[model samples]
Target: MKENGIYGLIAEFEEPDQVLAAARQARAAGYRRVEAYTPYLVEDLAEELGMHNTGVPLICLLCGITGGLGGYGMEYFAAAIHYPINVGGRPLHSWPAFIPITFELTVLFAALGTVIGMLILNGLPRPHHPVFETPFFEQRNQSHFYLCIEAKDPLFDRTITQEFLLKQKPAHVWEVLA
Candidate 1:
């Protein structure tokens, strides 16, 4: 099934249910590496892939903490240590004055972290992928759903995987090439 050098085996499905069932079947069959493509969102597909716990929130939290500390420290150093100008008999180390800027910085950094983390996790800016070589690729942009079992997977075998995909009752099955 080496069509122009095989990257993997891809199956095309007509409905989200078919793709979801196909992904579940692949997972149940001990296939650890599987990918699904669809024209729109299908939440169950991601659940089947066990992609529920992304670390974006943790990244955002760390960034927010760092930003808050940095902002507060900078203000503290500037007013309390460097300048030390007491205004209206108020203490030089006034934490209340730092709260607004510290909060702002925390939100800004957290937002930035969320964006950067998402792009990094999703492998963004990727202009090309081997799946694009499949003839059914065009259909993916329209209405078709695709599930691919990568060749690099530990359980992959050309004949066996092809048979497995065929058993999923897809519209078409192809040997994806790099």
Candidate 2:
């Protein structure tokens, strides 16, 4: 546990199903700070770990609306308010002329917002994590799966958690240090 220098304990399994089972068990055991790592996607594993909803979609929607309004507003100000120019006898506040720029800005802002929001939401730019120190790739096949119970979990106790993980019958149980 985080009581000392321990980040948590990580259990390595040979198959995806094994890690998935361990994740479910850990969740049921009241470990809230659980995390899983696998060679590929295991969709059900995320549900078991309570990693469902994210705010990236809301961020995209808000940013898209802002970009569209901003683009249209800028065009209106430039063409009608700042310097009115009636080309071809068209009205100064021609909204049709603003559509292309508004559409482009909406898409651009949404895409950029999605990326930035995902990074911020996921705590990205993490050059290093405690799990990275573990020998996950070393001592076994390349397709191993790992389930970690972080010390931040309220139910974490070094001795008891170690015993619990042993009961899961993992291929290997490692004490991950922070």
Candidate 3:
């Protein structure tokens, strides 16, 4: 279905098993830029397609640590240096008093960082994707599954990819146009 310049090749499947098998086969063929669209969740599909660890957790942890340190630092500066109001002759640099705010800030920054990191990693805020251009893309909501191997994949070649998808025996293979 090469209507114009190719973005990639998309294979439509009638069943989850078919798409899953196709994905596994694609991975075995060394296709790294494969993606799958299904009406419902398909177990192990992500793993089969080679989706794995990302940096979101690391980002969250770093943000949490920074927030905890910042919160503690702010309180320390205010109590020990900026204000230093001695309450009941208690220590002005009381670290125990800073625990609550530090904990809150750590949780807050970690949550915010997780949300932001996920959005960025997923390439969110986009209004369109080339797969949407497929005339049959809407079928994805009605029990169809689609697998796409993007042109950006190092192993991608239009003819070769199309033939490869054809070998999977999909319902039909379409060229996803950019």
- Top candidate when judged by TM-score against the true structure: 2
Candidate 1 lands at a TM-score of 0.90
lDDT of 2 by residue, 61-122 (tens): 99999899999999999999999977999999989878999999999999999999999988
RMSD of every candidate to native, in Å, equals 2.3, 1.9, 2.7
lDDT winner between candidates 2 and 3: 3
- The top-ranked prediction according to lDDT is 3
| Overall local distance difference test of candidate 3 | 0.89
Model 3 clash pairs are none
Stretches of candidate 1 exceeding 4 Å from the true structure: 1-4
The TM-score of predicted model 2 comes to 0.91
- The Cα error of candidate 1 at residue 124, in Å, is 1.4
lDDT tens digits, residues 101-171, model 3? 99999999999999998999989989888889987687554778999998888888888898999999998
Worst 10 residues of 1 by lDDT: 1-10
Give the Cα error of residue 90 in candidate 3, in Å: 1.9
Look at candidate 1 and tell me the lDDT of residue 84: 91
Which residue pairs show backbone clashes in model 2?
none
The TM-scores of all predictions, comma-separated, are 0.90, 0.91, 0.87
- Native-vs-model 1 lDDT? 0.89
Cα lDDT, all candidates: 0.89, 0.87, 0.89
